[model samples]
Target: MAEFDDILARAADGGRIEAEDALRLYTDAPFHALAEAANAARERVIGDDIVTYIIDRNINYTNVCTTACKFCAFYRAPKHDEGWTHDNAEVLRRCGEAVDLGATQVMLQGGHHPEFGVEYYEELFSAVKEQYPDLVIHSIGPSEIDHMSRVSGVEVDEAIKRIKAAGLDSIAGAGAEMLPERPRKAIAPLKEPGGRWLEIMEAAHVQGLESTATMMMGTGETNAERIEHLRMIRDVQDRTGGFRSFIPWTYQPENNHLKGRTQATALEYLRLLAVARLFFHNVTHLQSSWLTVGKAAGQLSMHLGVDDLGSIMLEENVISSAGARNQSKLGELIDLIRSGDRVPAQRNTVYERMSVHWTPEDDPSDDRVRSHFSTIVADLQQKA
Candidate 1:
């Protein structure tokens, strides 16, 4: 107990812990003690008075993918009858809906289509920006850049430059399931290597395009591997300092190849969140994943060093294709934050607070701000 306390005290005193120490804290530390320490660490970095949530929509443009990852239930094989890509009109219409519903950002993520290359994205993003100039286009990740670069016969840096020129405001942390080699290969063998992923992200940052880093836990990854994931991200952040946030969400085990081998319990997820807060001394923001884990666990995350509760996800298809059906409305979400004794603020894509709710009366009652299932999921339900 004394040793653990000393470690926590050192972390509180601004000392960074090593990977082994982090693993110990993740595996051995008591739950309440870890949460307390992490909460303190969070308060030291970003004050604990307010918790933020984003009003954004995830518009999956297409599901036609080539890399058949074992853990993914979101993608369809190339030329599969079930596969579909949204036309430019459809994409713009979705963006229009987002704007009408008071969304400040739209995360446009999809599969790596064979025909879609850098030009495709350039045209699409340019069209979106030409129409909805105010909507922040937070779309794609390193793997998508790699795919587009390979397909369009250009370099990753060139691809990022083109997309940014075409009006992509930021990159979402989409393809980083697990950063270590073992788990990454086991789950997603065809994707770029973990090191290559980091290299591409560094290139993006150097080119002045900042992005978030994400890790999908509970995908049969060991505790050591999880710590290694954090270590790798920390190393990158130490150099470039471009990562806006570090988001760790759970891997939903359903309708995919890696069937129910193992899943992270709520306790395990919370422990890792606490350890992540202590370990990631360089990263700025840590987000909670209510989309995969449940509302209760997400609320508990506020007390365990999470300052952001992620997006209300006006429309999500990836995780919902897996078995996570959790959804929230604007008022309900605000109430969730208030129930945790924290102020709820509506934030934009760049983490800027658009509005702050100081009391219950201050909360907005816009029903259009709730989550919506994707058309694919809606179709599946209708068939069932």
Candidate 2:
């Protein structure tokens, strides 16, 4: 196979690697060549060897979902015996645990509960903010916002505005499994359409709210469909410049409605990671998700153009409910980045540096910062 010399050079040199160009890299390019190109692009754009992580929690407020995506094992039907919704006080108590352990951001992601309209979110956000004035409410993506708008009999714009006014800090960009039709429909037919997700994201961006874009690959999506997903996000980003980071994670195949059909291998995941860093030139950050793909794979991503290694996720439920059992403590995460031979720094939702650990001595003493995926109220009070 011929090396993708020309394309690699183009991507590394600040040229916009088009969709077709990305496709070729995914298919024909030498694996290491693609990685090097991606790493070069990452350093060129973000600078230095400093990789960033956020001290955050993935909080699932309610598991009762109207959109029961086949790929999601976290959601429960409203009438189901196991269905549950955490009260605002419960949510607040969980946030307190996260904040005590050094978390600055909380990802309030869950399923689209049928009755959770704009007002529901408005109250939730308002209370969360009032209690934890310093914690950043990086909650809600476009799909949930669109669903809520319809539930409340309002427009997407109005839904977003009301939530933001109620102290929503930013969009989490969850639920963007795959932006193209084939794979999208194959996985999440009940969720809002893929294009509508982007539409809502752009609207939020226009209204001065920034978001991090995400792609959930390996859900029977072809390489072409994957590229198409990047294309869709890129097009929207060109317009609003709202995507602060691009995060690509593989699908978990446990306990979901899907047949557990096809999954992206580690190599394929690496290819996609490099392709994103190369293709998304306008995006400032590329996050490597260890929570979904294990710690080692996440570390490998640093050499393949990932500038951020995602979070020290204090709590998670969605991915775990689907059998994603990988775990990491703050010390282990720092070690993983160091094993990749890169420096690790703590970052906020917007990629602002909070703290940098240049050496082991710089590591924090708080070891209670492990992720807790408990749905029980009692477990939420107990620190990991």
| Superposed Cα deviation of residue 97, candidate 1 (Å) | 0.6
Segments in model 1 whose C-alpha atoms lie over 4 Å from true places: none
For every candidate in turn, the CA RMSD to the true structure comes to: 1.1, 2.3
Q: List candidate 2 stretches off by more than 4 Å.
A: 1-3, 373-384
Clashes of 2: 0
Enumerate clash totals for all models, in the order shown. 0, 0
Per-residue lDDT tens digits for candidate 1, residues 1-384, read 777998887775568899999999999988888889998988998865789998888898999999999888999999899899999999999888888888898999999999989999999999999999999999999999999999999989899999999999988888988989999999999999999999999999999888999999987899999999999998999999989898988888889999868888888889989888899888878898988889999999999999999887778888888888889998888999999989999888778888899999899898778887245686778899
> Which number leads on TM-score?
1
Q: Per-residue lDDT for 197-273 in model 2, tens only? A: 99999999999999999999788888999999999999999999999999998898988887578788888888899
TM-score, one value per model:
0.98, 0.96
Model 1 TM-score (2 dp): 0.98
